[model samples]
Target chain A: EADIYQTPRYLVIGTGKKITLECSQTMGHDKMYWYQQDPGMELHLIHYSYGVNSTEKGDLSSESTVSRIRTEHFPLTLESARPSHTSQYLCASSEKTGIPSEAFFGQGTRLTVV
Target chain B: DQQVKQNSPSLSVQEGRISILNCDYTNSMFDYFLWYKKYPAEGPTFLISISSIKDKNEDGRFTVFLNKSAKHLSLHIVPSQPGDSAVYFCAANFQGGSEKLVFGKGTKLTVNP
Candidate 1:
């Protein structure tokens, strides 16, 4: 089983509230990614990190920011939450060796900005 | 323009029957393809993968066939069980300096027991 974990399986917050979704993995993976998706919809990449101190925005535009100070942790933060931000956030990791290109995913965080 | 696309929104199959899910991609740079399974409110789980060098890959009870010429791929599951019901997503990775996975819209598979 993949050792990735995401906190607050479900969260409900008011608009303008700042919140952070925590993600961590026990495996020593060099690549990490964050994706946003609505129920039953396709996943849109929001942010990703190549390694510590390396972060980049993904295909989909997001009003969120992420930091990679530690290889095991990649957290996504919303400075000012909005109703439009309500969706599922998924965190994933992959080894840089590229042997197994498949990514291991966390259980995911379901956020509701009311 | 979406790089990856799963045209089927949902698929249904009876128990012990074969279930096939299809995906298409436009980017030739994507040499690595993967299939992921996800449950409601849960994250996607890696199911299987294939490289561009090969046209087919198989894991117990699951097989993925790739057609580079057509830019299409299909995942087949034999003896489908109710437990196999979940959302299936297709993703592609470009073998480059910054390797990342590009995902499709996803197809929900319902295995009726």
Candidate 2:
């Protein structure tokens, strides 16, 4: 089974508050990614990490930042969250083998800024 | 332009029937394709995947078909069940999983018992 996990399955906070979404995986994956999804929309990649201390912005622009201090942990932080940031945040990880491999995803954090 | 596209937003099928979901991609660089199933309030789960070298890959009730020339792929579910009601997202891996995955908008499948 996929061992990736995300904390705070659901969250509601006032605007201007800062928040951090936690993601971790026990599968020892070298690649981790953060994606944002809105209802009826596609999952958009916001941030990704190749390995420890290797972070890159994804195809979509995001206000949140991510840190990969350990291979098993990757966390996303949003500074001064706004109502526009209210959406579902998904974390995923996959093996870095050159061959094809499917990614494992976390339960996701549904963030709402009121 | 969206690299991957799922033209249909949703589809409804009856139990014990077949459900077909289609996807198309604009980038030929994508060498691996996958199908993901998601439910409400949960993250997506890997369903099945197909490599560019093969045209079809089957796993029990799920089968994924890839057409490299047309840049189209599809997922078929045999004997659909109510439990199969969920959103299906088509994803493509650039350069055979060496790069990030590109996802389509997703197609919601509703299977009535």
Q: Root-mean-square deviation of each candidate, in angstroms?
A: 1.1, 1.1
Candidate 2 residue B49 Cα shift, in angstroms, is 0.4
The structural similarity of chain B in model 2 to the true chain B, as TM-score, is 0.96
Question: DockQ of candidates 1 onward, in order?
Answer: 0.68, 0.81
* iRMSD in angstroms, per model: 1.7, 1.0
* Candidate 1 structure quality by residue, lDDT tens digits, B1-113: 88999999999999999999999999988898999999998889999999999999999999999999999999999979999999999999777745778889899999988
Best by DockQ: 2
* Model 1, runs deviating above 4 Å: A98-100
CAPRI class of candidate 1: medium
lDDT of 1 by residue, A22-88 (tens): 9999999999999999976789889999899999999899999999999999999999999999999
Q: Which residue segments of model 2 deviate by more than 4 Å?
A: B96-98
